[model samples]
Target: MKQTPNVIVIEDNDDDFEALKFAFEEDGAPGLDIERCTTGPEAEHALDRLRDRAEISREDRVLIILDLRLPGLSGFDLLKTMRHDSRLRRIPVVILSSSSNQSDAIESYTAGANAYIRKPRNFDEYVDMVGSFRTFWTGCAELPVLG
Candidate 1:
């Protein structure tokens, strides 16, 4: 059976989170289990919670959509932590940020981010981006099982 993937969105801005959520819903993503974390610390806590879940196995799917700039810990720090932890390193991290800087993208990629995507300026663009995201992550990509 195909396991449903859990999407962990690490975005601090309320409006941006809502916009992304709306885009996901509009994109016809079924069985979309989303977890929103306002800060990097909150996201770390959430991921740790999932890690401790007895029902969660290594075969379970998980995808982390992270923002570069956060209130508490920066995205780079979080990514580094995840990469070092054996239990979390397998999970693919996708960087979604408003920053369009080459350094940010290069740094994200260098830090083991699977993908770096810039946040869209408008709702239409966001919808399209989300659509592509859904298609790639859910439809095309083979995700690692969360244990």
Candidate 2:
């Protein structure tokens, strides 16, 4: 069977999501498929997609990029659930919010986010940041899962 890298991006902003998609394509992430969920409820449902045997039980790596502030359940709460869930606890979570507040970073870590990354200010920087994410999830770094 063909390998599919499980990548999830929980973001509400359309522009940012598009930017991330564009950057990943440019970076050449093989077998990388990004699933976008615009709201907290949407993200929750998206997580259900990962529960499928076709998606989860193939020795694939699952990485989640989450925005800290989201409508409905909120990213912080989502992180908590992801960390606690038996089915989802193994996936690594990266907080890619625009929030520069230390509290947001601290709270995300406190809630079990694997990484906290502040959004860049400029377009070039944003692209660079996306490249970094590609590197982290797809390149040399080894992903660690709780489950």
TM-score of each: 0.93, 0.87
- Residue-level lDDT of model 1, residues 1-147, one tens digit each, is 445589999999998999999999998788999989999789889878866752456566889999988999999999998888788888899999999899999999999999999999999999999998888888888887765
Q: Top model by TM-score, which number?
A: 1
Report the Cα lDDT for candidate 1: 0.88
Give me the candidate number with maximum lDDT.
1
What TM-score quantifies how close candidate 2 is to the native fold?
A: 0.87
lDDT string for model 2 (27-59, tens) is 776778788889999998877766664244657
Each model's lDDT: 0.88, 0.79
Candidate 1: Cα lDDT at 139: 80
* Model 1 weakest 10-residue run by lDDT: 50-59
In model 1, where do residues sit more than 4 Å from their true spots?
A: 54-56
Error of 1 at 73 (Å): 0.6
**Where does candidate 2 have its weakest 10-residue lDDT segment?**
138-147
